[model samples]
Target: MNEYLPLATLLRLLAVLTLTLAPHVGHLPPWVSALIAGLIVWRGLTAYRQWRMPGTMVKIALALLAFVGVLVHFDGRLGGQNAGTTLLCVMTALKLLEFKGRRDVMVLIFLMYFMLLTHFLFSQEMWTVAYLFVCVLAVTAVLIECQHRGALSPRITLRKGGIMVLQALPLMVLLFVLFPRIPGPLWGLPEDSAAARSGLPDQMAPGDISRLIESDEVAFRVEFHGPVPPPSARYWRGPVFDHFDGRAWRDSVPTFASGLSSRLELLGEPVSYAIMLESQRGRWLFALDMPAARSLPDDAFIGREGQLLARKPVTERRRYELTSYMQYRLAPELDEHARKRYLRLPPDFNPRTRTLAATLRTHYTDDEALVTAVLRMFHEQPFVYTLRPPPLGRHSVDEFLFDTRRGFCEHYAGAFSFLMRAAGIPARVVTGYQGGQHNVFGDYYVVRQSDAHAWAEVWIENRGWVRVDPTAAVSPQRIEQSIEAALDAAEGLPGHLAARTRLRFYLEARWEWLNGRWNALVLSYGPELQQRFLERLGLDDLRDTILALTVLGTSILAFMGVLTLRQFAPEPVRDAALREWQRLTRRLARAGLPQRPGEGPRDYAARVAAVHPEWAQAIHHITQLYVRMRYLDDPDPAGQNALVDAVRAFKPRSARRRSWIRS
Candidate 1:
């Protein structure tokens, strides 16, 4: 089997296989990728040394071992993207060992194509898509070489392959535009598609959000149809934690009291916008604080505490239109269940913080006054807003409030919520992004994970859950400006956000704008966009779309076929001359005057003349001219013209006699 494959083809196949597996390294188990690399190295060495391949039994044993390893590593769950991709990768590596002939190469190449598709399951970023396209081109070149029987120059093969891809681009674009797209997932998404992203977690531990502040990954991007909201009003609400354990805050089972309709009264014109959210592998959707009651996406619902909840986990780039009113009230008249839930706090925790809350309650008569007193305390006290805050013990709130008055937004929000609850006011922590950077190039706001924030929402008798940002009191710049502007210059921000040069910053913004457009126009192209595209072509329903597609497809196919035939078809006069020469040789062979291999035209003509003396002069003249025109370096144009005439005029006398006898 190995004898059939040339060394060049084997090397090319190995190169393509190596590159195809490179992108999956980060997603696959470390050992799996490492095993692949080792196998590739061994295969290359074997090919170079002309060593014998492993036996079938040995290959089988190795494959079984790899399969067992995958099962063990993936917890015996041979389902979804992770396990399935791992299995694919393992089997692909094993396939290299069993490489025999062209059939195996074809099978290997098809597997490579499938592996290329799996790459998009994990990432659809601009760079990722570009990388996959380049891989496709290389794989296509290998496929072209496999089909070619004769040796072709590397440059020529690559050029022809590239041309083929370029030729297909227009048709591909047409299909993408006219194809009937299925809404949402036509098939179940692989579990590996969902990854852990740097966003608000379901539960907030002491330093949970502080860890997220360091990451500059964009959580989402928002484009306003009307006007961009002010930074102070841009509170993108996420998870509302009602259940407070001793150490952390988590959402608990909803009670009827918490579910009571707050009947939010809109004060002004709603701000309409569309958000392109990055997948967070969770159901929570980030919306501006105080969103309209019914302004959520079709797949989303407003939770009891006014947080947007998606029906399914967000495993892809999701675009949803939303209208939010920054100024609105909910549950102004706090219900009993709501009071019990929001104000409920674990006993035997944060004794010192509770004492201070009691002290503040005695000093202030009303709930509003108590809230103001807490804000004043945060402002007057030496509460340093820093990313690198001292770690707290079990009593996180007490330690932050008294001992270490240095913390992030979570610290401030947690302490504030604790004080409010201790002072007999219903309060809970609301976690989400606070501010976003406005990209002038894109005309949209980019909210990064660094903008992740938390603040207190204390329930007032007359005024529902009033948003109290204690971090603002401690550091007003954080609310007004960005995380970088708020933090000291000594603690540099993540490299992407903190550009060293003005030109670099401008280029970054431009690239980001291009990526934003790519996501919206390309990645977000779904059934609705496809339908709208067809509507522009006067094709409305599925039936019309199919009909129009059939017509367009047939026309494209016919045009392509015509182009192909034209490329392969010969030139008229040149083809006729060559065809006549071949026919004369066949006639001579039939008359027992056949030319022998390596016999020069002059030698063959002499032999033919000896056998049939009647055509001697004609044969001699034609053979002399044919030799001088084709083989000799004669610049005279008359040689070619005379050779064509001599060949057309010459006729084998023996064949003519046979034809005459038959007549």
Candidate 2:
């Protein structure tokens, strides 16, 4: 294989392979992929004019320098994205050296494989999967070029490469379906692979949600099996923060009191679905209200806070199955401590709202009636909800209510809750997104940053707590029509968020539907589903080690099979050289001289010369022709078939052995 492959062609193909893999590692340090591209470009420019490769010592020094830079920049923790990316990037740079042979191309092919794995570490998105496949094809193309470099032109070599990988599709799919699902985070793996999952944190500082709004990334996605719930009902309860000290909010308790039972249940009309919440580096589960049963795994616990949380920090694409009962009621009976905590407010806070709550209290008969008055004030007053809210001065709850009535959801919810507590009603602010866009493509919903909302939930008689949104008083269309429909400005905003083109509308709707299905089904692969999945396939005790072994075994055997077929298959070379030699012999026999089969080519030419001296030059030419055509066709293949014509008309006399005395 090494003997046949031409070096120059392999280098060109490897350049193309490296270039094709550029986008997979786009999230890494910007210059990493750029440096690789630069290296490839340099090699190509040099190759185009047949210049010398960069000096060997220079390559060695660069590799050492790149490795040290990766170590120092990643702070010596050479693992996960920081490590995999470094390995891939530096390897591509190092590959520029020794890239002048078939084996060199093989090394590049391996590097490309590692690059694909690095892409998975950053994002396992379906589209990224598709692009990685294209990278794999490019790698395969280089391998095929290494094999047939000299025998075929670059265009023909690429065609052969495509045909080969396409033929390999069946085996790849068969292996993917049969691959076992690993039960947990890979054994002993480091924690940094999930550098990309950005979930809402449990602790709430003054500007916690403020920074989150700056991001348009999805925290999670939901799809309904039945008629989709209204955007107003899209309350995804996650972590419950109660310990507030005027400046920041923390958990009431470090550990959940309800334990795993909070995520489980006896029975209900199971709103069957899956949720793939991106890792938030915390142990909270973001689910629709009232999870009927927790279907993740034994380790994932349900807390009394009405939150689904894993036993450990979610360091990967966290997925779980849930059947939340939309109609299920939270325990209406509040414990002594829980009630006291709900009413606890900063002392001497919001003097004006406190006075107003007292005035309203005298006007209303009961706590429930007093609650209606607060919402009424928002509706009747000139209070407005806008993203561009007036900058809150000190004493936020006070400034928002009396001074600047122009506040967003958080402002309204905060001010409204503070007033309710003063009126002798236990209330808390609930902050989450509102009015999700309905994606008809997957028949589900998508919530975005613009949908970030806050509202109030008040404790009332008979009912545990009822939801109230003062912001809704100002923007009714927000709950009714979704964030997209609530947009009043058609001119200003980021191009991505602004409604500008009809095409944006079409694509957003289309991809929203597709992403909804991806989250619900694919992102939902977890433990309970793992067991049920195995049970459906009739396998128990699925082990990570076993799955790893099976995939490894199949890959090795398949690779061997490829090598064997290439070695044993018939070689497509010219086998007709002997016929040309025989033709020359027959012509000589007709000219009255014969030669034995054991005679050598030069000896036969001598015999022919004695028989007919005038035809000796033609006879001599024909005998030698077979040797050159049969053995040598390198560098150039012009006049490859012309040798046959010279032999056909030759005069090598051997009638006795050729035709058993043609008479």
Candidate with the greatest TM-score versus the true structure: 1
Model 2 lDDT tens row, 1-663: 122234466466656666656665555566666776777777666556667766879888888887887777788867765676666677776786657765676777777776677666666667877887776766766676666646456577667667777667766654444456565544334556554356565565434554555566676666666666666667776666554455444566674545545323343565666566665566766666667554545666567656666777766556566767666545466777878887777776567777888899899968878887777888898886555566765467777778877756666776777788778787776666665665666665566655566667787765766678887787777677754455454223434566448788788788666765664456545554555665665555557435754776688668858876897887764567766666666666666666787888788788767755767777677666666766655422443466677865553344334555654
Per-residue lDDT tens digits for candidate 1, residues 218-269, read 7999999998888988999988887889888888874112232355666677
For each candidate in turn, the TM-score is 0.83, 0.71
Question: How far out, in Å, is residue 561 in model 1?
Answer: 2.0
Superposition TM-score, candidate 1 onto the true structure: 0.83
- The CA lDDT of each predicted structure is 0.81, 0.65
lDDT of 1: 0.81
Best by lDDT: 1
Flag regions of model 1 displaced more than 4 Å.
149-151, 190-192, 195-198, 254-262, 498-500, 572-663
Instruction: Find the number of clashing residue pairs for candidate 1.
Output: 0
Instruction: State residue 161's C-alpha deviation in candidate 1, in Å.
Output: 1.7
